[model samples]
Each structure stands twice: as structure tokens, then as C-alpha cells.
Target: MQERIPRRTLLAGLGAGLVLPAAARAGDLAAAGWASARGGEGGRTLRVTTLAPDGPGSFRAAVEAAGPRKVVFDVVGVIDLGRKSIRIREPFLTVAGETAPSPGITFIRGGIQVESHDVVLRHLRVRAGRDGAPDRSGWEVDGITCWKAHDVIVDHCSIAWATDENLSASGPRFDGGDTVEAWRQGTSRRITFSNNIVSEGLSHASHVKGEHSKGTLIHDNATEVLIVGNLYAHNLERNQLFKGAVHAVSVNNLVYDPGTRAMHYALNAPEWEGRAWQVGQLALVGNVIKGGASTRPDLPFLIVEGQGDLDLYARDNRAAYADGRPMPELRVLPTTPLPKVRRLARPPLWPKGLKALPASAVEASVLATAGARPWDRDAIDLRVLRQVKDGTGRVIDDEKEVGGYPK
Candidate 1:
């Protein structure tokens, strides 16, 4: 946390999130960090599953074959697990779903769990069937859960119908009677949640939370998360939840058909009571949110209710209601004047990279390119994808969209 400065000091450029060398960064630092996510490059490629027991055979077998070394495995067929899930424990692993034989790996039941560092998941589709309790207990399933994990990227996949959350990156809890130290949960750091379709989740579409044991939530411990260029749809609440984060960036994303709330940014000092992230260096720019037809009927565009102080900044984010009318600026309570941009992704994810397209363009691209490949856009109703044009005068459609594995 940065030390507080008097209003006069801020006028002289001495505020917490305001004092920065103007020439330190060039162009969009958030976009560069997001583009530099390369998973399992040093590992050997092992082809697995799809009917005929080919090269490395089953997904589990190939991962075990890699042993402790970083391995890149191409899932070449459909894996129909009845009520099970696969957890990748090895660090530096990549699961390329584009290599799958047909529509990519479709989990009629199971899901993928990356509990390791330097991991990447792309070009896959996970469908958690209805009545989402695999254990026959209360619904608490996630399409992908990165617990106590770091240096990961989840991209170009379509995940749907999770009872709890579709995607989540949370630290494990530190046991201490009832209440536990949030910072002491785990050393989970340097993760990117981007370029994927996380929709139809019963709870939060995505959860970027830390370990909250008792009633008191601690977000001062979660750090270095980059969320970019993805489509969030049909979630019960929090299409994108920024409960607590030390240094987080959300850019060029679209939220369609929101259920409860669209997004939240709560940054205060010390402890942010109920959320799970610490607000260190925050950058929230170029986000598009909409629902209904000319009205955003979910909750609010974003909720800024916490008071724990940290470097906070938000800009270029627009929202529309269900009636398709433009919504007003966000309401940030105990409002601190909008801060300036600062680069926190040092040695960025992509030192020489690019950002996702603009939200107007991203909405069409996400819907067109999301889901498995070989999908007939002519078959599905175009209205389902939120095909709306923006001020840029570009028709939102499947013209330059990109996702999934190329045939």
C-alpha cells in the first residue's frame, strides 16, 4: 500500500497512484502483458486420446510420462469421463485443445484442473451437464480452478454450466482455528485469465479470490492477475469478480446477458472485509458491458464500495442496459479521483505483444470465434451472440474473429 498524500500534494503530483514518471511506459502495458503468455514451450509434444490409442495414449498416461519435466500435450480426441476430472500437477505444461480430432476435447462430465505453475489451456470446450453436483452434494464445480497455482494462462476455450464458478484462480487457505491470514494462504502469483468464453455459470462466471476463512475477508495477499479479451455471459453473479487483487488488469472484454451483477472493483487499505484481493496497481480499461435491449438490467456496471486504500485506476469502460441505451459512468464510493495508468506487470507477460481488440469488435469476435471449431454460424441465431455495432461504425460479426484450433 502507498502512503496517503494530502489533496494539495496531489495537486503537485504527489498522490499514491498518481506519482509516476511520464516516460516510463510506451503504449498499452496491459495489452503487452496479456500477449506474452506462453505455456509449456520447453516440453516435448505428446499426442493423446480420440478413440484409437495413439502416441502417448490417455491424457493421464502422457502427463505421467513427462514425469517432472515440462510437457506439451495435444489432446487429439474426445475424453468422455463419466464423473471425474483431471488435475495437471506438473509445472510448465500445455494442453492444446485445437489438436483434438473432432470438435476438440468435450467433457460430457469431467473437467480440467491446473494446480501447477507455467500452465496453459487453449481450444477446449467443457460442458458441465445439468444438476452440476458430481459428488451428489451441493453444486460446487468449476470448469477450471487454479488453486495455489501461479504463472498460468487460460485461453481460447469455451466453458459452461458450472454449479459454482466456470473459471477461478484462488489461493489455498492457511489453517488457523477459524480465521486465517490471507497473505499466508499461498504464494500464488503471476497469472493471466484471458481470451476464453466463461459463461452459463450458476455462481460467479469467474472468481479471482483469495482464501477467506472466517467472516473477515483479506484481499491484500492476492497479486499479479491479468484478465483480458474474453466473453462473459449468462452468469448468476459477478461475470468478472475483482474481489481483491494486488496488481490486476482487465481490458477489452465483453459481458453479455448478465444475471446479478456485471463487475466489481473494491480497493481499500489493510483489509477489504468480504472480498478476496488486495488493490495494489490496478488498471481497468476498455471493457464493454451490456444486457437486455437498450437497458443494462443486471445490477450496476461496477460496485466500488470498499475503503481499503491502494493504487486504483479505471477508464474507457462503457456499459449499456437491457434496453440497449448507454449507461452512465460508474459510481465509486468514498471516491478517489480517477488515477493514472501504471505498469505493474514488470518483465511483462509479452514484452513485445498485443492486446485484444476493442470491446465493440471483441463482442462479435468472441461470439464468432468462441466455442469449438467448425461451428455453423448460419445455423445459430445471430442475436444470441449480441451482434451490435458501436461508434466505430464496425458491424459486430464473425469477420476477423479468432479462437479454437485450426483444422
Candidate 2:
């Protein structure tokens, strides 16, 4: 699932949702960075009255409605997508899963993709399993992803069982841009992926690329992406990857049992063979990564792979093994070639009024408040959290391994 639309094309297609109010409320942004901008404020209320994927009063209908809208839900249960996804094309929208009755809402066998601007998604669960699709059958689904979408905030969501990434912000690498700044503006910008539980991306399940289990991919040219206070558990690799020319921040995140790698940066030579190479900038602060049963030995806290130059600022990041043994902070595998890593004196893009918790406090803080409706967690979420605490889980090939969805 790629979004290849050029920047100009996307701008030309903007509709009534682009006409947003001038002043945004302070509460809308609180902890999020540039993405703190308001979404659907002073807009119409559209209630999701059914668990259907489409038709009247369904989630699809509410999201597809024109203009700025705030989506509230009266229904609470698992919304079986029947193996399809809900693409949010309308802008200035807020899907507040917290507005639903008791149990809240969960989407099974499908996912959500944000392709518009000024969107806020909160307190939702998305478990996009393979649904018995054949191995390598191209049945790829992301829990929630944003592409060519800006000013978006996806917070406190429980996302799992995806054949692809559990959560990500991605788009075209370069959309006919003459300079580096133009390239960044062409893709997703000002996005916040905060306080989410991204886990168990299905390995060897349904992606066309075999054995691809990833947590998040902040693709090339994506700018101003803030990944904070999230719990990334049981994904094989790409606990989060910053591709070429991207600007991102990873702070106060708890990563457990990442198989081969934890956090990495790469820019493939083939992807930018003839184009001008743009440098990626990243800030890593107060984060924690712990190796578990599935993790390989001597894994670095941060790995720079393939081609491309990167400017990085690292401070107070910590790593440990399953049994509480400390690990190297910047150790790389002996055979792996390193990319050009330039050190920065200070953070280039820190969020406003953001005070990162100490690395020692990351695990407790993330586990307690991360994911959708932390007060009312489901069986699968509780199981994953327990495994992370006890060091007892590995990446799986199917949701059946953990007992499929709830009845």
C-alpha cells in the first residue's frame, strides 16, 4: 500500500475541510508537538451508531462525510471489517473512540489509513490479522498509518496483528522536489504517534515480502514526526526506522524483545541512485530497550544501515537484557557496515513544553498509560503487557497463537 501522489496534486484536491478555524484550543495539543493543532473543533458531530464497516451510521459513513466532523460512537464492540480497510480521506476529523459505551471499539481483520490533514485518532484498537490468507498472498494491513497527511495525532491506540507495520507515518520519498525542504513538505508532516501499544506484527503471515514483521516505518522525506511514550513489543525489527532525509524524534518509548534490531536509520542506494542525497536528522532521548527471548545478542540501541548520511542527537538512552543485564548503547554487529553518523550538540526539533521522563521511568510510565483505554484493557493487550514484564513472548505468525479475537 503506497501513496505516490505528488504534493501539488494533493494540494489541488483539498476540499471544505481545509477551511479550519484560526485559533486552536490549548487542550488539543497538550503533549503532542507540531501536530497539536486542533481537529474538527467547532464542527458537526457525526456519531457512529453501528458496528458495520459501511452503510448508514457505520464508521465508514461517518469518516466519509464532507467537511470538518467529530466522530463519536454510540456502539461498542468489535467491528469486523470483512478483510477490507477504512481509508479516511476527509480532513479536519476526530474519531474519539473514548466516546463509545463501556468496552469501547475495536476493528478486526482491517485497518485505518489517514490520508487527509488535521485528524485526531484516539482510544481505538485495531487488530488486522491475516484472516486465513495464503502465505505471501499480499494481504498486508497496517493498524493505522498516515501518508501525505499532516497535522495528525494518533494517540492511545492499541494496534496489533498487522501483517505490515503496526503504526507508521509514510509517503513518497521525493515528489518532484528540487531541494531537500521541498521533499519534506511533499510527504507526511507534523505528525504525532504517542502513547500507543504497537505489537505483534505478524511474521511470515501475509505480506508479499516474506518474514516482514515491523513496528513503525517513518519513511523517506517525512518531517516533524514525534514518536513518544509508546510501547513497542514483540515486533521482529524496525521498532522504528527513520529513512532518508527524514526529521523525527523518539523519546520516552519502551521497546521490548525486538528480534534483530531496535531503532535504525537507512537510505538505500538504489532508491536514490541518481537523486541528490538528503541528510536525515533524528533525536533520541530518555528511551529504553530491553532484549528478551526473541532478541539477538549484542544488538545496538541504535543501528545505522545501508546508504545515506544522518545527523543524530542522542542523550540518556538505555538498554538491557531480559535478565536485567546491561547492554552496549552504541554497539553494532562486527560485520555490519555503518552509515555516516554526524553528532549534534542539541536536539534540532524538540516538542514544545515536552519534558521527557528518565530512562529508568520509561517502562513503568509506558505500560501504565500507553494503548487505547488503559483503564479498560482487553485480553490480548493484558497478555502482551504481562509477557513484556515477564520476558516470555516472541513474534508470532498468527493471532491464533494467542487466541484470536474476543467473542
Candidate 3:
């Protein structure tokens, strides 16, 4: 008779061999140009300049020169204040017959481009030229772009002001044509972006393209994003009007402010279709939002707009209005456990010596967080489920149930 390998036993065997001592694995991975799996110390740090002889252009050259593997851009404390104002001499010539408008900076030719892996961009300030043009045109070049890269990090950078709302001479009416053409195309994955500021950068007047921009984490862009505490303000018109497919995770992010009028609004316009088809499950928790002063408003603390069914789980969110009037309806739902759906019917075996456990293991764990087991009833917060008239309502105890809380 063949020996029956217990599932747990098989898992332990697979998981055992791959577990390497942290120090040894760290050294090996580091030498191989891979990030330290254990987040170890003693790694090489490469610094590159983003301006001047060793500026953004030079930085690109340096990356090509240094070759890839465990590199850091070290862009902290780099500011370009030399060019006080970027004046467009022939503004009238660009837009003939119409009123000539002044834009601060102009990128007539090639824009900025970047290609690297495991990169970090920090502490850089990019703004509109100080000519006081009606439109604050900052950098005429294509905005900071990353191409064919993975595990990239963009932090503490500021991008604001741009040339024409619409790049074409036709003006802002026909979708900011000039602005639309400015975006660069590339493939990026596993990106972590935080504490950066972006404001007045892309004009609301431009038309946008590219449908494959995916897998991004946009958070803590408070300064130029304008709202406050990682809020996303400005570009409301363009954000609302854009139609593209973006797969991203937005968490603990503020979307608006009170002094600026209302509290919160959708990141995208209702007309736009972002992540319409391939939107993954979104987890929105602990978000605070306020609505505009308008009598009829569309402001919601959490708005997941797009196609496809979204298994969205929102908890501990506050949504209030400016008016003293009481809220008519607050749409809150009870936590419901999702049915298990495996990406692959059969579990993939771990590489030899890799872990192999019951296929349902991770799923069972995730379901617990969603209030799955009978014991989870005590853990579920009723405040997030139903709105009761009084804090202490009558407690009804019937036959004990064996499912999600409140069963």
C-alpha cells in the first residue's frame, strides 16, 4: 500500500527547506540584485543627480552606466531654482487669431523619461514658472514617468503647474489636446507611492489616453494634492471626465476639505469609466468625508465607480454634510462573508522544498476577517451594521445560531 502523505505533513516538508537563515539569504539575494527578502542591512546605496551636468538627464545616464540591481536615486534635498521663469516667447504664434495666452514653461521637444527597478524618488519640488501666466505652466515635459519597472517607490516629490490646459491651439474646448499628448506610456508593477504632492500639474483641459496603467498605490500626496492629510483635491473636472482603466488601492486617503467648499467627492467623475472591466476587490476602511453645500449633492464618503462586481468592504467611515439637517439615509451594510473562489482550481505546488498546505488555508483566514465563523459574532461591531434609534436597544436571545454574527 502506498503511504498516505497527510496534507499538513506535506505542507511542513515543503515549507521547511526554503526557510533559510535570514543573514545568509540576505547576502545571497543582495548579491543577485534582488531585494533582501528579510529586509536585512548591509546593502549598497547608489546616489544619482536629477539636474545640471548630473541632473535628470545625467541621472538617467548614470542608471544606464551603473547597470541594474539594488539601486537608490537618493534625490533628497534636490531643488532647481536657477531658471526663475520659463517664458514662451511666441505664445501668440502658437494660438493665432485667438487671444494669446502666456504659459510659464514650455517643453518643445523630448520629455523626461525613466527606466529602472526597485527605485525611490524623494524630496523634489517641481512647480510652475513664476511669470504669473494665467495658467501656471510648470514643466512642459512629460510628467515623471517610469517605464517597464517593478517594485518602484516614489515618495516626497511635488509636481505642479503645466503649459496649456489643452496642448493644441484650439484651446480647452476640444479636450486639452496638448495636455493629453503629454502622458508617457510604460509598464509598472508593485509600485508604492506615498507622502508626495501633486497639484495644478495636469490641466483639467486635456484629454487622456492609455488603458493599461494598472497596479498603483496613491496615498499621502497631501501638499500639492491640496485637500490635506493625503487628500486629493484640484483636477476635479479632469478626474471626473477622464475615461480609463486603472487598477489601484486607495486607503486612509482624504479626498477633499471644508474651506474649499464641501468635504469629499469621488476621485473620478460619474461619466468616467475607470477600471470598468477588471476592477479587483477594494477594501475601503476608516475614511472620513463631507459633502458640498449644494442642496442636491453626489458626495459620498466612499464611491467605487466602474464596471464589474466589486467586493468592497467599507468600515468605520464618517460622512457628514455642511447643513445642520439630519442625514436622511446612510447606506451601511452588514459584513457578509464572501464565497471562496480559487484563482486556480488546483493549488500550485510550491517550488521543490517550497510550502504546500491545504488549498483552503489562506481563504479560511481571509474569511475570518470578514466575520465568517460563529465565534466571530462577538467580534463584529454592530455600530457599522444597523442604525438603531438608541444606543441600548432590547437584546433578543433566541436559539443560538452557528454562522456570521447576528445569526
Over all chains combined, what TM-score does candidate 3 have? 0.40
lDDT (Cα, 0-100) at 320 in candidate 2: 87
The best-first sequence of candidates by TM-score reads: 2, 1, 3
| Shift in Å, residue 106, candidate 2 | 0.4
* Per-candidate RMSD, Å: 12.9, 9.7, 20.2
Give candidate 1's error at residue 96 in angstroms.
1.3
Candidate 2: pairs in clash? none
Q: After superposition, how far is residue 269 of candidate 2 from its true place, in Å?
A: 1.4
Residue-level lDDT of model 1, residues 40-118, one tens digit each, is 6765776663332223467665554543333323444445555466677776666665555433465545566777777
List candidate 3 segments past 4 Å from native: 1-64, 68-114, 128-142, 162-186, 202-229, 237-247, 257-279, 290-296, 302-306, 319-407
Best by lDDT: 2
Each candidate's TM vs. the true structure? 0.67, 0.91, 0.40
Give per-residue CA lDDT, model 2, range 215-287, as digits (tens): 9999998988999889999999999988888899999999999988799888876797578777889999999
CA lDDT of each prediction against the hidden true structure? 0.50, 0.83, 0.26
What's model 2's lDDT at 252?
90
Better of 1 and 3 by TM-score: 1
